[model samples]
Target: MLSLRGVRKSYGGTPALRPVDLDLVAGELVVLTGPSGSGKSTLLMIAGGWETPDGGEIVPRPPLPEVPVDRMSWRDLGFVPQSISLFEELTLADNLALARGGPGGAELLEALELGHLAARRPGEVSRGEQQRAAVARALVAAPSLVIADEPTSHQDHRRARLVLDLLRAAAVRGAAVLIASHDAAVVSRADREIRLDAPAVAPG
Candidate 1:
């Protein structure tokens, strides 16, 4: 559904990414893995249109005529950043509801084992719980393209598995899922893996 051709990025004098190409299709789960600072997040940001690549372009496949053109673009994309970015003032359930723009927050909370914490604010919850809530929010919208950065970093094995299962379920439901992580379990469960080589530092 989406493709990045010859994407590259740099910060100041350092090259963060170099001519990376990626393709994402419905019902597939792909993992992006590499060492720290290898541009996994950069690539994702570019894919989600949050970051402008220094070179190359993100080409999205044309949508069917019945689908509104405005809804065909980034509106169908969802992102879960490395940091848990829930609304601090809202309860967990409320945050999820806002993401979903309707009911069903309760069901998602229950599925993620977060129903008990639904009434609490993000600040009141543990990082792991907050992480799960973040994941829930991302998937709550049932977007066509899901991009997650280090989604399992804060969860235990069981919770990590739960997150993976949720992501996989999203794929089964025809959302193209791309996750950036160093976690072995996450990588193992993915349908495909793309590794970014270490970024090269530009000469002084």
Candidate 2:
């Protein structure tokens, strides 16, 4: 389980996220949605340890005691940033392989209907294809915690459903999945939804 207690963030005295509390449990998929600048991405980044919050702490619990949650590494958490961050020099398959630590990239590609583009580099594929590839990479590692920001933004209805199904499957496999998206398709399929409001400003 991942829990955030009173998590808050600000930028140069401008509040981005207000005091917030959230819990992500294993075997569940949680969708975070709101308008632009509502701090959805900020919250996801904070959960994934990619960004620091001005206040509050994140506690992660690993299934096994041998691997302390506090000591968890990136392999313990799979994150897909809003920006599809793929290795431009490597083929899509190669990128997935790297994430998987070797082999098994083809299966994911086939599932997402990107098997035919496996040999192509990120630069060569369309943005939607690249986004799909990024998602596949995130799950290839089978991390305990999955954090994705606007994962379906570049996908169509069919592809979006495919991706959501994949995420749902990951949750069934005991991974806590947290996605930040405004798409109704994604929200409707989530086990739970967390809505964040943009920070309010005080009048001068």
Candidate 3:
């Protein structure tokens, strides 16, 4: 299971995440929900190894625990950040191959109903389609843990459901899934929910 013990983080002198604690098991989906600046994003980033906490211990689902965030090879962790990180100049297939290191791009695209857009560039697709492509890229490697930040922000109901379905499928395959989002629809579908409040500074 993925566990965080007394996690804390801050931006400059300002605090962003408190001493939050959470646990996520394989085959489960956890949703982090809270108001803006409540440190939801900070908590997810720390969990995904994208950011380091000022103090605490982070234990991955397996094969890792109490390791430094920088020392962790989080490649096994699929991530869909709040921003769509697709190559506007490259075709969808190329981007997938580059990110996933294999040929599952087309198959993932087909599953997400974006097969027709495979030959097109990210700029050529609609915002929602691009979002789906971003997700597909993350899934191509079949990561053990999937972390998405505001994944359904720009998606319509249909597309949002598709995204959630994709995450659920990943969890079914024994991947621990954690999503940080404000959308009630997304949070409601998760197997578990974690609410991160504002960061609490440590006493000297």
Off by over 4 Å in 1: 61-75
Per-residue C-alpha lDDT of model 1 across residues 113-136, encoded as one tens digit per residue: 999999999999999999898888
Residue-level lDDT of model 2, residues 24-86, one tens digit each, is: 999999999888887898888788776678988778623332322222236677777777878
Q: How accurate is candidate 1 locally (lDDT)?
A: 0.84
RMSD of 2: 4.3
- Count clashes in each candidate, considering only residues at least 3 apart in sequence or on different chains: 0, 0, 2
Worst 10 residues of 3 by lDDT: 64-73
Off by over 4 Å in 2: 61-73
Clashing pairs in model 3?
17-199, 18-199
What local lDDT does model 2 show for residue 175?
99
TM-score of 2: 0.91
Give the alpha carbon lDDT tens digit for every residue of 1-204 in model 3. 689999888788778887888887899999998778888878877787667789988885244324343222345777787667777778888778866765666878987889988999988888888888888877888889888889999899888888898899999999999999889999789899888775455457
Per-candidate TM vs. native? 0.91, 0.91, 0.88
